[model samples]
Target: MQTGGHIAGWRHARAADNALCDAEYFQALGRTAEKGLFDGVFLADYVGYHPVKGAAVFAGLETPKLDPLVVLATIAAATRNIGLIGTASTTYSHPYDVARRFASLDHVSGGRAGWNIVTSTMENEAHNYGFEAHLAHADRYARADEFVAVARKLWDSWQAGAVVADKVSGAYTDPARISAVDHQGEHFRVAGPLTVPRTPQGHPVLVQAGASATGQQFAAANAEVIFTSHPTIFTAQAFRADMHTQLAQFSRSPESLKIMPAVTPVIGRTRSEAEDLKRELDDLIPARIAISKLEGLLGNVDLSGADPDGPLPALPAEALAGENSTRDRVLELSEREMLPIAELARRVAAGRTGHTIVGTAEDIAETLIEWENCGAADGFVISAPFLPGGLEDFVDMVVPILQERGHFRREYEGTTLRENLGLAVPPNGFDADPTSRRRPEIW
Candidate 1:
């Protein structure tokens, strides 16, 4: 289980314009991750602004953020080997465009790019993109199913050695080596010879961050890397087991998909010091701001000025519907733990329900290894409580501990991110001529 970090600091920034640290900041972070011999850095990107009222907790920060892929592209030029994964919404973008962009990045980075597929969950995002309301969750997944299939078709459109670039006869490509993809799906219509040739990895690795039932099925079929959310070891174990079940349904090898739950760390030289740091970060969440966020997520059930130690106000039957999964997960955990509402809210605010492993290096390593061996996760998507420095501590401290345990690699295996991660190479494009292709007789 190698580590990764998301470039996120917009919410708690003391500065007025702390959307994302500048390019120099990303480059420095990339260099640091590489120095630790970590697998890669994955960025969680979102399309459009998060919903302010119905499902998101976006306060004090500007909405409709930077394009993650573009940011990773710039970082690609600055660093050598660390993986660059960016989120691209399948609901709004076309498959062909996505296929080209990722393949281009893979080439530029020498096969070190990853794509985190998301179906935008925010209703506000839909309106901003010209939809009156968000599509039903199942409908979005249905479209995503088709979208991923089409993207894969496009990615495999050109085989390796397709581009001859021969000058003698002015023949740039071997005509027989590439052909159009005739794809007619419910959600996409693509007739293609992809604009870009084959990437060094065949395709940039496919990553999925869906935890819904429908989403899990899609990940089983398509994703080589599964980015997931879990609030506890119990939940993580259940999720991993569920994923394997789904993978069996898809007739795919369950071991092939890497499951990484989000793990946020607030580290210090001592456990007591780390706890203080965590408290400091949590204390920064203003009561009004936290209330505003909670109300939004709870569908306008205002908990403002309510006693934090008191029982939660009774929600309507549908109050929890359409809430952020991470927040919901936290609520469930709090209920399970029988925590007082005040402490629950503070903990939830710190990392949004993902496991927050705050401790010394040995302690963090032990927790991670336990999770890995106990079906809690294959790995983690480690996020920091603070900025670059928070991540720096993990690389310097936690990574070496995992390495010494013979749990993580000392070096990468292959060139492509997929190869380095031990994932399989995607197959080539249409090899046989359509005219010569014939179906086998049915038994």
Candidate 2:
């Protein structure tokens, strides 16, 4: 998360100075995560200027973000083992380029790269890519489905024994082991082998974050690591249950995918200390900026004249028509909880970026265990309110408790992220023996 997930995280006293575009800052973050044996560090991306202006212009929101792959590559040199996941949109990028980049990343990181696949629906992103408007949601996912298919074919183009450095014979490669994809699909057409060879992981882990019906369908068929969000435990359970059913229909084993919901943990030694920190961060968000974010989320409907403390006005029909997963969740929260404008805006501001928990390490740890054991989640994508300090707290405080309880790992299980996550390495589509790529059991 840039600085942190919260809108006001940069202003927090604990946040590092000059983190924007700082390579060392991220390298340090990577090392810290590895110290705690985290699965990976996820780096988010926003390609173009967003329509929202108030927050960026006033609240010091980190914008013009570095390319996630470039940043993650930098982190790769500084740490080992943790998966380096970066966002790459199927909408704006071609399958060949996307596959090549991640293949190279997987090679360099020793098989610890993940692709957080997104079908971007942002009009602003469309504008930058020479499109008058973003594609429809269905069209986007359809493209993504094909995009991934092509990428996989490209990855599998080179078989395991494709490379053999023969000195005397002077044959550096095995032609029999390499094949051209020659793919012609509805969304993409790519011919031949990827420029990069087969990666260390065979294929980079396919990650996704889509909660809509079409989103779920795509995720169920493809995503190896699914990033999701739910404000309540019950909703999380419902979503996971639905996903499991969908997975069964696909004939995929339950262990094939991991569903991770983003959770922001505001931690402290005592309850009061944690509550104070949460309020302190929330209080940093300016009223105008908070309302502006809500406006953007609600399809940029003009809320300038609306009362900041009153209930949200009925969303316009136009806004309703373009509703996305994030927008729908915010609306659902408001309708279900009857939260006022100010309160709702505040939650959106202060890292209700996902479900937020404020408490001592024990309380937060217990909550995590409860969600896991109750079938509410397979895992969590922990989003700290502010960087360095917030993550360090979780690693030092919460992680230990989970480990002590025998629910979390005391040490990483294996070298590769797939191994650590207990996921099998994906087989090459071209392989005659699919199980050849399976990761050996570590435990």
Candidate 3:
């Protein structure tokens, strides 16, 4: 499948597990991914940790949440070919600031910025950000739609060649080159003529990671690359079909949005070795930690005494929150497969519903090609559980295999991320309007 890397678990190598990761480490990862012939590196960020029994969640396998924008900037400086994606929350941030931050990154990185838009879901995160509770899932998506609209308007403010650095005339930038978007939306009021000029790609690439009905609609209208999670091929195909339907509703097409589900690889030289590696990772997860994680995800159902070979405990109505869609979807998958309770939990722990492809490099390549060629997914957002080893193994073994086959790119085709991904460069807001848009009074 088309491959992309995510910087989630990669941040915990040196920093306190819960603290932010350093810029240098991310830069090194960017360089490594580029060398591996990967398309892009996406950074996933959460406003707050998952809560466990009324506390900010921090346990055996969780820690180190970094600000994705800062991390992306660092990586951008270190590498030129791999796309730099950063998660920006529409629920918590303003369109003006979001637009400016990404625009600056695009300029600094020579036009390789991508934004992963999300509606924040954590209650503790909401509290930390001055809210008493999380916004309802539907409501957050509604606000997010408006937020993106405003941000897009802001991004379209300045045209390329607007800045004529004419030293002879002492005019640093042509006054007649920018426009104002007096957008007054439900969630944001961004009066634009963004202070910064446009970047190589007029606006950074837009990405989304929500799977609810509202979120799917928003993505269909805006996202170029969608990061999704599905436990099985059936669900992934169903989701792909649903997203296509959404795209049709908007009179858009699937070609506009590339849907990539999260993926984890447990690779080894042999099938037995792969199985052994999976076992080792699970064994590292302590029982107390696993139980806490299971409860946090599947409601506080006490699975401590439940036999691994036994059936799953009954799910309660209270456990059916809209935000638990990712985990709940996995339960549905496990039940369909008739997997034992402990096996179900182990699979969930391994990748949090992202598919885990384990085996030799050829085995993984074959499986990924099948998934991509079928309607299962367009690509993958590759994630790993641990540090350098998790990424290093994939880059060393699986990438070359995929490259040998014709499915993956052997070399980057363009300098900018947008060009590399085969996306068109956007025209600035006022390239069509010379006189009217550039008036000083407009800003």
Candidate 4:
């Protein structure tokens, strides 16, 4: 159970405005997270522009960006302790290449690298990858299961002692210890050892963010860390319990996976100031943009004809089937609260379906602690509504309170990401012990 910061939302209006592509912004963000002794800083990814051609895509925070792994590499050079996690999609990436990239990052970062595995959900992403459309939800997960399996095999191809580098013996590597993966899965076929050696953490800690039933099963079998978004504590608790139950089916312990839900905090020295900041950001979002974004979240439902101040339109019966968990939450809230389209859009934009808190440092810290203590989450993937400023506030204001309460660490506990996250170094698959030779049950 630990804290991690996601800086994607930081590029929003009124906070670090127009600095999304700046390396310095990210470096400062990394340092701030490290200063707070946060476990990691995650960089989210999207390969294509919004499928809906609208202002939300043109005027939104998700503008063109640098590659996440490249961004993380820059962050790694600036920070000493914090883990750097980069999101890469399994559906669009080749396992061999993804394995090499993350493994290289782990080496360069002194083992503080994590790979956030995602099955590309946006249809635009599929188009970018030369596909007609995004794979169906279940099909995507099926591909992801094999994708991860191939990557794991490649990572394990080289044993721990594969690299001898003995100068006197005129030997660089132990050939006997290095072998080809020879993997031929339904979605991917990867051969031989990865270009890089076994990483510092055995392999970059596998992180997943899927929330579907198939997603939970894949995470239970493979993910060491699972990033999630839930609007309420009760839902988060239920999801965590479900993941643990899924873990048991894989013969894994509940402790094997860390469930970190997304939390966006708008904090100020005073509650009123926090409220003012939220209001400022909300006002900046045009109703058109908000409505467009909301439409995307609701399974691309056409909301243009609906009255902004009127109640939400009735959802299609099969809406939940193709939609994600966030959409489910949004629909549930709309139905329960009977919210107007305008109000619902604002709330969705504010937190993007995750829990959003507006308060002083003390209030924010108390809420976070309550969630952790109540089994709602193992920790949180903190989304600062705005960049350096929002992140800086949390690190400076809320972090101290959490530290003082002994709920969070004042200093990093370990060197590698796995060590810091309290995850065990996965046993090498080439090890002689039978227990150590089993592949990660990613399927």
Instruction: Score each candidate by Cα lDDT.
Output: 0.73, 0.85, 0.74, 0.82
lDDT of 1 by residue, 12-72 (tens): 3422244254777677777877887666778776565544433334544233445777778
True-structure lDDT of candidate 3: 0.74
Per-candidate TM equals: 0.89, 0.95, 0.89, 0.93
Full candidate order by lDDT, most accurate first: 2, 4, 3, 1
lDDT of 2 by residue, 1-443 (tens): 66778888878888887666888988988998888889999977767754666545443543447899999999999998899999999999999999999999999999999999998756889999999988988889889999999999889988888889899899987876777787878878787688788888898888998778889999999999899988989999999889999999899987899999999999988999999999899888887778777777666778777787788999879788843887898889888889899888888877654789999999999999999998988889999888888988988899989999988988889888788878898877778654433221221
Per-residue lDDT over 1-443 for candidate 4, one digit per residue giving the tens place of the 0 to 100 score: 01112223543443566666778878988998899999999987878755455544565534555799988999999998899998999888888889999999999999999999998667788898899978888888888888888888788877888799999999998766676777777777666667798888988999998787778888999999999998889989999998999999899998889999999898877899989877877786667767777887787778878899999978776665673765777888888778899989888877777888899999999999999999999889998887777888899899999989999997788998899999999877777543434332331
Per-residue CA lDDT of model 3 for 36-82, tens digit only, reads 86778888877775555434335354655677888888888788778
Off by over 4 Å in 4: 1-14, 53-57, 316-323, 432-443
Clashes of each: 0, 0, 3, 2
lDDT of 4: 0.82
lDDT of 1 at 362: 84
Q: Which candidate model has the greater lDDT, 2 or 3?
A: 2
- Which of candidates 1 and 4 is the stronger one according to lDDT? 4
Candidate with better lDDT, 1 vs 3: 3
After TM-score superposition, the amount by which residue 379's alpha carbon in candidate 1 deviates from its true location, in angstroms, is: 1.6
